[model samples]
Target: MASPADDKESTPLLFSPKGGGHLDPANNGVSDGPRRRAAPPPQPLETHYFASKFDPPQIAKVSTNSSKYRSENLATPIVKKIYSSYSIIKDAIQPMTKPSLADEKRQGKIYYEDTYNDLPWRCSCGTHHKDGIWLNHSDKAGLVMSSLVWLMIVYAGFTVTLLVNNNSLPSHVGVIYCTLCALALASHAKTALTDPGSIPKRAIPNEDNASDPTVKFCNLCETYKPPKSHHCRICDRCISGMDHHCPWMNNCIGTANLKHFFLFLIYVWTASAYALVIFGMNYFLCNSEECIFPTGLVALVRLMTFMCVGALIFTSNMLMSVFWGIMTGMGTIDRMKKQEDKTFDESEEEPMAFTDIFGIGSYFTWFLPIDPIFNDYDSVMGYSNAERLQRERSTLV
Candidate 1:
C-alpha cells in the first residue's frame, strides 16, 4: 500500500509513437554505427599470368600480391582479348634465342689487315685471253693483216691520183688530194702503233673493298682501273677509256687514241670515194687514146685492169667503214647524254638505252673526241678521277 503520489512517480515514462525507435521497414532510418560484417566464403584459386613488360610473355603462377586482392573485374576480359590476338601470331614467331660464346668468338677474330685485301678483282676477260700479262699476246696476226689493209687502201688512192692529169690535179686540188691521202695514212699508222692507255703496274693500296665507290681494283690484271676501263683479251692488260676491240685497227679503241681513230675513218672513206669518182669520170669522159695520155698504153691498161679487180674490195670496205662509224657514233652520243643527264638530274628512274641517245644533237659531236670534256664533268664516269675525290668527300659528309 503505497500512496497515489509514490505510485505515479514510480511508473516508467512512455515514448510517443513518432519519436520512438520502432522496427518498421518504411520508417526506420539507417543506423550511424557500423553494422556487423560476416566472414567471407572460401574462393577457388584461379589461373593467372605474371610477366614483366621487359621480358618475354610466359605461363606463370598467380603471384601472392595479385591473388590477395584480385576481384571479379574487367581485367579478365582484357586479358582474354590479348590472348586471342597473340595466339594467331605465336606460331609464326619463334622464341628469341641467345647467341653462343663460340660463335661470337669466331666472328670477332681478327687477322692481318691486308691479307684478304690483295685478292685480284675477277673479270670475264680471263676466258678471252689465256696469256697472262705480256706473254704470247694474240693480236700479232691481226696487226699484220691491219697493216696490209692500210697499205692496199693507200696504194689504190695513190695510183688514181697519179693517173688523174699525170698524178697532178689542176691548181690546189692536187695538193688537197695528196694532203688527204697522207693524213689518212699517218692516222692509220699512229692508231695501229700507239698503246691504248694501260693501267699502272703498281698495286693500288687498300683496294680490297668492292663496295668502296671511289676505286675499282682489277683482280685479273692485279691492278687498279678507273671507271669505263676494261681488260682486253688481245692486249692482256687493263685498258683505260676502253671502247671496243677492233681487229681492223689491231688495237683497243681507248680514250687517248680516239682522236686518231675517229679521224682515220673520215680520211679512209673519203679517199676511197674520191678515187672511185675520179677513175670513173676519166674513163667515161675520154676515148681510148686520151684515156692513156698520162701513163704508157701498157701501164694504163694494167692500172685499169687492177681497178676492175679491186673495185669490189674497195666498195665492200667503204661500206663496212660506214657501218662501224655509225655504231661508234651512236655509242659515243649515248655516253655523253648519260653524263649530261646524270650531272643535272638525280631523280631518273629508267636508264637511257645506249642506242637511243643517237640523234641530230649527238651527230654534231660524233667526230670530236669529247671524252676529255666529259671526264671532268661532275664526275659522271663513276670514280674515274675527280669522281673518286668527290666520292671520298661524300663519305666524310
Candidate 2:
C-alpha cells in the first residue's frame, strides 16, 4: 500500500561481521529519542586450540608403532639364525650311545659259528629265529661223505649177502639204487638247509611299505630281514622263510623242500632197518667154528660196520623227523592262535596246510618242483623231462 520509493527505504540490510550495516526499527534499528552505545566486540580468549585429521593434539601419545613393526620385520632372520646355531651346538654336545653288551656278545660269537649259515639268533626285530635249515659248502661236503659211507656199507652188505644166499641181486641194480638214492638224498638235504623262498626279512610282510624292527638286527649279515628269513653273510643272499643253511648239502633249506627232507628221513630209516635185518641174520647164521669162519673176519667187520652205520642213520633220521614234525605242529598252532586272537569273523583266516609265509603254495609247486616222479628234470634247471620228451617227439614226428 505504500509508495515503491518509501518501501525500498524502509527495508533494512542484514548485519555482518565485516562492517556495520544500515538499520531499521523493524529489524533492530535505533529510535530518535536517545543514543545507545554499541556492544563491545567479543574478547579473544587467553589460549586457543585446534585438531587435524592427520594429528590429534589433546592426547600427546608419541607412537613407536611404525618403528616397532619395522624392528620386528628386521629381527625375523636373526632369530632364525640364532636358533639354528644353538641347534648345531646341542647336537655336537650329545654323546653317541655305545652298543649294548648283548649286541657285543652276538658280534663276537658269529666268528666261531663253524657253519656258514648263522643260527637263528635273536634279531633286532625282537624275533627269536631258531629255525635254521641253511646248507653251506660244509653241508655239501658232509652229504658227499655220507653218501660214500652209505655206499660202502651197502656194497659190503650186498657182497656178504651173495656168499650167504645162492640167489643174489644184480650188481647194476644195487649200483643204480645206491647212486639214485644218494643223489636224491643229497639234493633233498641241500634243499632243506637252504632256500628261504621269497621274502626273508624278519617278520616282514611282502606288502608295500611293510616295516619290521628285527630286520636290522643281523649284525653278522649287516642287513635287515624278515622273521624266519636270515641273511647268510657267506652266501650274501636273503633267503625267504629261511629255516637254516646246511653246509653238508651246501644249500639253504627253507619252506620249499621241507617235505622232501622229511621224506629223505623216512627213506633213511627204512634203509637202515633193512641193513640191520640182513646184517643180524648173517651174523647169527655164520657158525662159531675154527675160531671164526674163513670169510668170517670180513663178514664180522662188515656186520659191525653195518650195525654202527645203521644205528647212526636211523637215530639221525628219527631225530630230524621229530624236529620237523614238532616245528610244523607249532607253526600251525601259532597260526590258529593268531586267528583266534583277532575278531571272530575277521576275513583273515589261518593259512592252509603247507602254505609258506606268503599264504600261497605257488613257490613250492612251481619253483622247487618237489615231486621226484612229476618233476623229472632238475628244479634248478627249470625244465621238465616231459618238455624234453615233447621236443624230441616233435622232431621225430
Candidate 3:
C-alpha cells in the first residue's frame, strides 16, 4: 500500500469513454491520446451473402420479424370460421361423391354393363325385355307358325260360333269357345313375351368359387353358368333351367316362362277339342234337310276339321311331354341328353315336383297366365355362393 490518491491514479479504468484513452487530470479530464470516433450501433443482419471471391457461400438468415409471414400465420376469427366451414362442407359431400358397394349392387349396376339401354320396354313385373310385345325378330319360323295358329283360332271360332248353322249356336257354346280361345291367346302371349330366365352376361357368383368344378364358364356369354342353365343358340344367351326353344311361341321355354307354356298347351287342346265336338254334333247328329251345307261351306268345314285334328294331335303330344318332364324332374333338353334320371316316387314327391314348376298357388291360378312366385334372379340361380356354402355346412353337421 500506497496512499489512496496514488492508488486511484495507478489503477486502470474498466470502461473507457467514446475515445479509446482514459481521462487524465493533467489534461483537465480530456482523452490524452488521439481522439477516436464512436463505433456505429450494431445493425440487423442485412448483408448476409459474402461477395468476396475467397469466401465460401453463406446461407441467408431469414428474419422471423417479417410482417407478411406473420400475417399469414395469424389465426384471426374470420380465418378460423372459414377453415371450419370448409371442413364441414367436405365431410357433407363425401358420401354423394363416393357411393358404397351395397348401394351400387341394389341399383343393378354392379359388375355388368347396362343391358337395358337398348331395350326400352319392360314387362308387367318390371323386367326389361329386348323383344317388345310379341314379335321375335330372330325367329321367322316362329312368327309364321304363330300367325298360322292365330289364323286357325280365328277361323275355327268364326265357323263354330257364327258360320255354322247360320249363327244358331247357343250363347253358352259361343261363350265357352270364346273363353277358351281367349285363355289360349293370353297364355300364348305370356309365354312369348316372358323372359326365359336369362342369366346376366359376365355375371360371376363369387371370386373364391372360381376354382370350383361345378361352376362352368360359358365362353359365348363370358359368364359363369349356374346349375341346370344351358346356352341356347337360338336365343343367343344362357337360359336358366332351359327346356327347349319353342317355335310356336318363338321363345325359349325355361324356368320363368314354362308355366305359361304348359297352360298354353292345355287351353289350346281344350279349345280344339271343343271345336271338334261342336263340329261333329252339327254335322253327324243334324238332320240332312236342316243342316244342308253349301260347297264352299263344306270345304271350309273340311279344312277346319283337319286343322282341329292337327292341333289336337300337336297339343296332346306336348302335354304328354310336359307331364313326363314334370314327373321325371327333367327338362326336354335333359331328357334328350339322357342325363341320369331322378327316380319319381309319385306318392310322396309328385305334388312337390308339380308345384315346383307351376308354383305353389291355388289350382285355379296355375291355369292362369301369372308370374311364378319363385321365378327370380336368385331363385333361378338356385342359391347364392354364400347361401350354398351355408347349406353345405349345415348338411355336414
Candidate 4:
C-alpha cells in the first residue's frame, strides 16, 4: 500500500548497512536476508589509578578489542615518561638547597665535642695540651690486643734469654739479645704512648689567614685542619702528617710517633732474626743426648720459634712499605688516596725526607725511639707560634 521510498522511511531500520546488514522491524527485528543476532550493550571501561606523582596517569582500558579505547591507553606511556623526567629533574636540583641546622644534626653532621675533656691526665706541650702516656681508653679491644702482644714479646724474650744462659753461648750474646728485646719493647711503648701530632681540638684559624690554601675546615672536628693532616675516627682527633692508625700500637702513626713505629719494626726484626739464628745453632751443634731440653722448655722454644717467624715476615713487609713511602714522599693514606706530592723531587729531597720523620740528628738516632726534631716545628703543627701569639694579643686588646 506504500511507495518504496515511503516504506524505507516508515520501516524504521534497526541496523545500518555498514553494520553488516539492515534489520527489518517488519520481520520481527530480523535481517532481510539472513538472521543476525543483536550486538550486546557496551560495558564501562576499567581504569587504573596511581597514587604517586611519578607514576603514570590513570588510563581506561576497554574489554572489547575496540581501537578507539586502545588509542587512549597509548597516552599512558607518554604521561609516564613525562612524570619520570620531572622526578629526575627534581632529584637533580634538590641537593642545591642548603641543608638546615636541624637536618645536619639529624644526619650526624654536628660538630664533634672536645676530645680531651674529662680525661684523667693531660700535659701542656708548648702552646697546646696533650694526652698523657696512657693508652687510648676508648678502644678496649685494641688495648687488650696490644697488651697481649706486649706479654707475648716479653715471654718470648725471657724464654730465649734463658736458653742462651743455659747453653755454652757467650754471656755477651745473651746481653746483646736482651738489649735488642729491651729496645724493641721501649720503641713499642713509645709508639703506643706518644701522641701522633694531634691538632688542638677546636683550633680556629686566624681570620686574616682564613684564605690560606693550607688551612681548611674539618666538618667533623669543627676545627681548622692543617695541610697533610687527616681525621682519625678511632682517635677522634685530627693528626698532623697522618700516615695510618696502628691498632697494634693502640695509636696513630703520624708526625710525632712515626719514628717510634719504624724503630719498633726494625728492633723486632733484628731480635727475631737473632733468636732464630741462636735457636738454630743450639739445635744443630749441640749433642742431642747431652743437651737434653725439658718438656716445658721445648714447648717454650717452639712458641718462640713461631713468634720469631711471624715477626720476621710482618716486619720485613712493613719495613719495605716504610721504605717505599720514604722514597715516594707519601704516607699510607696519601698513597691510598692517590694524592701525589707535587713538591717532592726524589733525587734531591730523599735525605731531607729521612730527617723529616726521624728529626735532625745522627743517622743512628733515627733508629732509636726518640722524638723527631723538625726544622720548622710550627709548620708541622700547621700553625706558627707567632700566629698564636698574635691572635692572643689581639684577643687581649
Q: Candidate 3: misplaced stretches above 4 Å?
A: 1-135, 202-212, 291-296, 339-352, 375-397
> How high is the CA lDDT of each candidate model?
0.51, 0.44, 0.68, 0.70
Candidate 2 residue-wise lDDT, 1-397, digit = tens? 6564333322112212233324566644532221123343333222222222222243445456778667877799989999999999878876434354356567873111112233345323211134333434434465675556456545655554454443333355445445444654554544544343433333223222134343334555444454445565445565544445454334544454555554455445545555555445545665544223245456654665555576557548555644643445332233345558863332433332444322244564432325422221122211123333334446566
Q: Sort by TM-score, best first.
A: 3, 4, 1, 2
Name model 1 segments beyond 4 Å from true. 1-138, 164-172, 201-217, 225-228, 287-289, 293-397
TM-score of 2: 0.37
lDDT of 3: 0.68
lDDT of 4 by residue, 232-346 (tens): 8888878877888888888888888888999999998998998899878778887765466656689888888999999899899999888877777667787666535555445
Clashing pairs in 1: 120-219, 121-219, 162-167
lDDT of 1 by residue, 1-397 (tens): 7664333311111211223332223322222221211332232133122222222123334454674336435578889999987986775564433244345458994222211223354433221222122222366787676877666766655555565556333435555667767777777766665555566555332222336677767887887776567887777777765667677777776654665676676766566556556566657776656554454544743564465346446536645643543444323333455678875332432342222222123555544433223423222222223224434546666
Between candidates 1 and 4, the TM-score winner = 4
Candidate 4 wrong stretches, greater than 4 Å: 1-130, 202-214, 285-292, 339-352, 385-397
**What's the TM-score of each model vs. the native?**
0.43, 0.37, 0.59, 0.59
The number of clashing residue pairs in each candidate reads 3, 48, 0, 0
Instruction: Write down the RMSD of candidate 2 (Cα, Å).
Output: 30.5
Q: What is candidate 3's lDDT per residue for 311-350, written digit by digit as tens?
A: 9999999999888777766677867765446543445433
- Model 4 — which ten-residue stretch has the worst lDDT? 9-18
Best by lDDT: 4
Comparing 1 and 2 on lDDT, the stronger one = 1
Off by over 4 Å in 2: 1-204, 207-224, 233-236, 285-297, 300-304, 307-397
